[model samples]
Target: MANSIFIPLHAVPSGLNEIIDLIAFGFSDVGRSVPNVYSAKSSDADENWKDNFVFVEDVGSGERCWVSFFETTPDVTGNKEWTWLAGVTARWSWDFAGVVAYALCSYADSIVYNDSGVLTGQEEYSAKDLKGILSRD
Candidate 1:
């Protein structure tokens, strides 16, 4: 079984394409190359229009991870919200997993959200925090 974690993202300011690119760049910055990355969106009319997902494969070890983003109804504050579901397969080692987690946290921290037509705070996540989250299961 693969070890995985789901991160809830609130008020994501960027679109799916931009997020995907950001994650890819994050991985590259850490020297953990991802040779293949792919994305797809659901075409079924019955499904929510926000349904989209991405898959990333490590260049050297062939380990794989995936991310899925979906929008949720606004809260009482009426701010746009979303969820970021991400995971890595068991094929990855603890060190590699930590590296990936760091990359993810870095990407999350880089996101700047717009609130009430103004760019406000940035997303927050620490690599150490993410590593602790990923170490379970």
Candidate 2:
């Protein structure tokens, strides 16, 4: 079985198409669905939309995770609020090279690794030594 984890991004940049494509390649099972990603909606009370969340899945192992982006905002009392706006649902297995490659190539800084394992697309990072740089941080 593949391990899963959540990767939270401060915000999803405009250049997300390429990353999505890469994630599709990395995971065998890729599906596009309308997800209730926004947290400000009234329907979020019971978490009914939780299942509606879209994600990528690893067909081989059924390991999956979701990516959510929320804009920071101030509430009525000036308190911080993580207003979820949009996100992607992804499911994957041990072979996450393609996912890693897509993520690194698209937005290396926004990446948040939840699990430690052999990542796909090691070749692309070889020259740039992304792994080395990432590890240092």
Candidate 3:
């Protein structure tokens, strides 16, 4: 029932490549399959959450999540389907909050400060802080 988590990034470690690599590494660290990440073409926008690291958990849940990045600001466009952090955005459409949260933290240097708990009334989460959060269903 929780929606999204926002990881505020100072700057992408290197570029889009690092974002893809760290997310893959982070997912592996969280026990999910390392996902294939690619770029979305501006010429042919699908209007779906594509062109980023995406994966579906096949262990029964089949929950889906996608990552979207922005420089100046994120175009929210009144999309309530996503939970937002601050720097980078990771959206879990159904559940798997801990997995997405863990991956974002991995990107922002193993620890991140977020104000994304508007729906959950939680705040200030870190990578080491996610052990309990990730333990839940």
What tens-digit string does per-residue lDDT give for candidate 3 at 1-137?
43455665545344445555776666667566655554453332233333343332434555555555444333441223223333433354323545555676766554444456532356666676664555433
TM-score of model 2 (CA atoms): 0.33
lDDT of 2 at 131: 37
Worst 10 residues of 2 by lDDT: 28-37
Residues 101-130 of candidate 2: C-alpha lDDT, one tens digit per residue: 334333423333334433443322331343
Candidate 3 residue runs with Cα over 4 Å from true position? 41-61, 71-97, 110-121, 135-137
Candidate lDDT (C-alpha), each: 0.46, 0.36, 0.49
Q: How accurate is candidate 1 locally (lDDT)?
A: 0.46
Residue 47, candidate 2: alpha-carbon lDDT: 34
**Residue pairs whose backbone atoms clash in candidate 3:** 4-83, 6-85, 8-87
Q: Cα deviation of 22 in candidate 3 (Å)?
A: 0.7
RMSD of each: 9.9, 10.5, 7.8
lDDT of 2 at 28: 22
Q: In terms of lDDT, which candidate is stronger, 1 or 2? A: 1
lDDT string for model 1 (56-109, tens) is 666778766665545544452233543433333334543454444455555555
